[model samples]
Target chain A: MKKKDVLLKALKCAFPYTLPILAGFWFLGFAYGYLMNVSGFSFVYPLVMSICIFGGSLEFVAVSMLLSAFAPLQTVIMALMIQARHLFYGISMLDKYRGMGWKKFYLVYAMCDESFSINFTADIPQDVDRGWFYFFVSLLDQSYWVSGALLGALFGDLVHFNTKGLDFIMTAMFVTIFAEQWMKEKRHFSELAGFASGVIALVVFGPQRFMIPAMAGILALLYIFRRLVEKMWETGEDTE
Target chain B: MKMTLWQQAATIALCSLSTMATRFLPFIIFRDGERTPAFIRYLGRVLPGAVFALLIVYCLKDVSFFRYSYGLPEAAGIAATLILHKWKRQMLLSIAGGTAVYMILVQFVI
Candidate 1:
């Protein structure tokens, strides 16, 4: 296939997977941009932060950080805490992302939750270029977010409608993805561990600070149960 | 805003730096050709499921069950998503349906 043909094919294959993200990112990004605008910052803040930070949750948190005192150290620590989950994403993508040359850097840079979820799970056709497929997925998802942020920052409060519960789109997306993963996997230990740990952490730590503890709990439980978990996979008893 | 222009820049820069650090650290630590530890390899396989689950919870963490609406909108929206996804197996359809349901519920019902 020609280079253009390959790139086009990869984009074509990748675009559908990102359609759901298109909606989620646009709405959430718009909300972020709108929030930043109302909070006394210019559109440039959302544009720059969305492009640079790229992590949706962290960018929103950064907006609040920017509103507060000039605590650069706190900003860094908060960012690391909020984004620690990307560590799991990076670890998972290690073998998949290796040897992609220059693209590897952007791939890692754009490893947000949406991009990682699609890239990690999507079963790309064998003939398609894996690198380009991953690249377009990351690029398209980011573009939706950045463009949405820009739009919201520019025309946020001016053109307002009832968008109250639109943020639920994100939760819906995650739930669907979780269900999809559940259908694919044989054993449910990891899934249960994730759900249970997250719920426990949320209850114990409250909404303000549950992620770190939830992650720690998940990691600890996974580590403690490694022998049994590995045995389950090894025995293949749960194979569908 | 209490922050100076340079302070804002520094804060954003620090955020970008730390976020990148988390994403890049694992690959940096376990480079190509050098064997990745067995434990890390096992985690790479199983962690995605748990991570997705965590993300779902993260998205809904702000819901106040003790307050008004008591998370009914979220519950109904998730049900719509779950049922739609199970029945049709279409990603966009499920998300759209669930979101629309939540919007209507919160805007009108609740």
Candidate 2:
């Protein structure tokens, strides 16, 4: 296939996978932009932050951080904590992300939850270029978020609509991914451990600081049961 | 708003830097040719399911059981997503349906 044909085929394959994210990111990004607009910042903040940070939750948190007294150390620490999950994503993608050369950098840079989930799970057709497929997925998802944030920041005051529960798109997306993962794997230990540990951490640490503890708990539990979990997958008994 | 323009820029830059650190650290630690540690490779295999679960919980971290809506809209929305996904296996339909359900419940019913 020609280079353009391969790129076009990859983009065509990638677009369908990103449609859900398009809706979710636009709604959430618009909300972030609108919030920033009302908080007295110009459209520049969202545009730059969305492009730079690219993590939706952290960018939203950064809005509050920006509003508060300037504390660069706190800002860095908070950003690290909020985005710690990307560490797992990076590890999981280490092999797959290799060998892409320049595109590898953008893949890791724009490794938001939606992009990571789609790139990791989507089954590219045999003829499609793997690197270009992943690139389009990441690029399209980022563009949706950036455009949404730009729109919200620029025309937030002009828009008037009831979008009270529109943010649920994200939660729905995550839930669907979780469910799909559940069905794909035979062993439920990791999934169960994650759910139980997450709930426990949330209950113990409260919403303000549950992520670190939850992640720690997950790692510890997964490590402790490493032999057993690996055995389950190895024996093939864990499958449905 | 309280910070000067430079301070605001510094803070945003720090945020971008810190976020980049987390995303890049693993690849940096285990360079291209070096053998990744066995335990780390094990983690790569099993960690995704748990991480996805954690992300789902993370998204819902702000919900309050004792608050005004009592988390009903979230619960209903998730339930709708579960059902829709289980039935259709269509990603867009499940998300759109669940979000629409939540929007309605919060807008009028709840």
Candidate 3:
């Protein structure tokens, strides 16, 4: 196939996987832009930040960081702490993204939760090229976010609709992914450990400080049970 | 904003730089051509299941079970999502249906 044909075919195959993200990212991205606009930053802020940062939670938190006292070091620490989950994403994607040449950089750069989930899980057709499929998925998802941010920043003041619960789209999406992952895997240990650690850390540390501890706990649990988990994967049987 | 334009630019630059660092570090450390360590590979296999669950928790981190609504709306929304997903096995429908249900509950019912 011609390069153009391959690109088009991959884009066509990739579009459906990104549909849900188009909704979720636009809603959340628009809200972030609107919040930034109302918070007194210009539309330029959200436009640039959404493209550059690409990580949703950190972008929202950065809004406050922008408004507060100027502390660049603290901002770096906060970004690292809040966006630390990308480490897991990068580690997981290492093998899958290995041979993409130049596109690997952008794939890693645009590795937001939604894109990662879709790219990681979607069983692409045998005919579709995986690299282009990943590229289009990343590009399309990022575009939805950037466009939504621009729209909201440009028009936030005029809209007064109640979007009180639209944010739940994110939660619903993650829950669905969790369910899908649950059904795919034979052992539920890692999933349960993630849940238990998250809840325990959330209860002990509260929302503001739970993430780091929860991650640490997950690493410890998974590392400690590496043999058992590996056995379960190999045997596809409950090791417990 | 209290900071100068340059300061603001620098702050945003730092934020992006730090975020990309996390995303790129592992791949950098585990370099493509070289053989990846067995332990890291082990993590690559199992972390997705745990990470997604953790992400779900991250999304709901702010919901207060002790508050007025007491997380019932979120609970219902998640329940709706699970049922719709399990029943239809359709990703978009489950997300849209669950979100719509939550919007209604919060907008009028809750």
Candidate 4:
């Protein structure tokens, strides 16, 4: 197969994943835009932030931070903690993306919820171009985000429809993702691991400092019980 | 009481920059292959644990815990939801149920 054909085929394979991502961005971006506008910020500011920073939770937190002056360390810590999930997010994708060539960096960088979904679902066609598939997904995901932000910013300023429960969209999105993952293999052990580690951390560190430690404990358990863990899931059929 | 337009612009601009920079930073700094590098790999493995920590806790940040706390009602609702999630294995239903229960408590029962 010609290399060019491979790339085009890959692009076609990745087209469908863009829909959910676009939907998420539209809702999420709308919420963020409304928050910023209501908080006394302007449309252009959010428009730019959506384009550049693109971090949803952080931006939400940032509206308050901007109201007050925070030290650099405080700002950095807030951003890091909120995004701390990405660390584990990266780990799962390690082997799958090991050989992406020039696209490797962008692929890793762009691995937000949407990007991760399509990529995790990716099955590189032996004869088709996986590169184009990846590139298209990445491009489409970013476009959804940028477009959604701008749209929200434009509409949010003029229209103040009651957005009371809309803030829960991120929570809904995460829950949906976790449920989907759970369904794929019913990896009950990981769920148990998550629950156990959380309870332990909650007891030890209380609610405040539990995150970092709980994460450490869960990973440690996964390592020590790697064989047992594998056996637990080995019974379930592979999602593939 | 009134914030000027550029002030709004500045606020949003700063916010947008801060948020994007945080999400995008490590991606640009670290190579994808180096995801296996010690620090990055450690983070990757702990992803779920870390996120679970944030999710569970952050949900509690706004409301106070004691002395006629709204959080108490909300927490009760959330706890019930969590239990339902584990037993029934229903995501949408659990959340809707929990949120509805909390809303009822907040609205009437207190």
For each candidate, give its TM-score against the true structure. 0.97, 0.97, 0.97, 0.65
A55-88: candidate 2 lDDT, tens digit per residue: 9888989989889999988888888888888899
Give all candidates' CA lDDT scores: 0.91, 0.90, 0.91, 0.61
Give TM-scores of the second chain, every candidate. 0.95, 0.93, 0.97, 0.82
Candidate 3 scores a chain A TM-score of 0.96
Candidate 4: give the clashing pairs: A6-A129, A7-A129, A10-A133, A49-B16, A53-B20, A87-B44, A88-B47
lDDT of 1 at A106: 96
Candidate of highest DockQ:
3
All candidates: interface RMSD: 1.0, 1.1, 0.8, 5.2
lDDT of 3: 0.91
What lDDT does model 1 reach?
A: 0.91
Model 4 agreement with the true structure over A150-231: per-residue lDDT tens digits = 6776776676554443334334334444544555554566656766776677667775466667677777777777667566
Per-residue lDDT of model 1, residues B32-107, tens digit only: 7899999999999889889999999899898899999899889999999999999999988999999999999989
Instruction: Tell me which residue pairs clash in candidate 2.
Output: none
Writing each residue's lDDT as its tens digit, candidate 2 over B2-80 gives 9999999999899999999999999999877889999999999888899889888888888888888899889999999
DockQ of each: 0.84, 0.83, 0.87, 0.19
lDDT score, residue A201, model 4? Answer: 73
lDDT of 4 by residue, B48-91 (tens): 43354345444454456556664666566666566667778555
lDDT of 1 at B28: 97
Deviating ranges (above 4 Å) for candidate 4: A1-12, A122-128, A160-173, A198-210, A233-240, B1-110
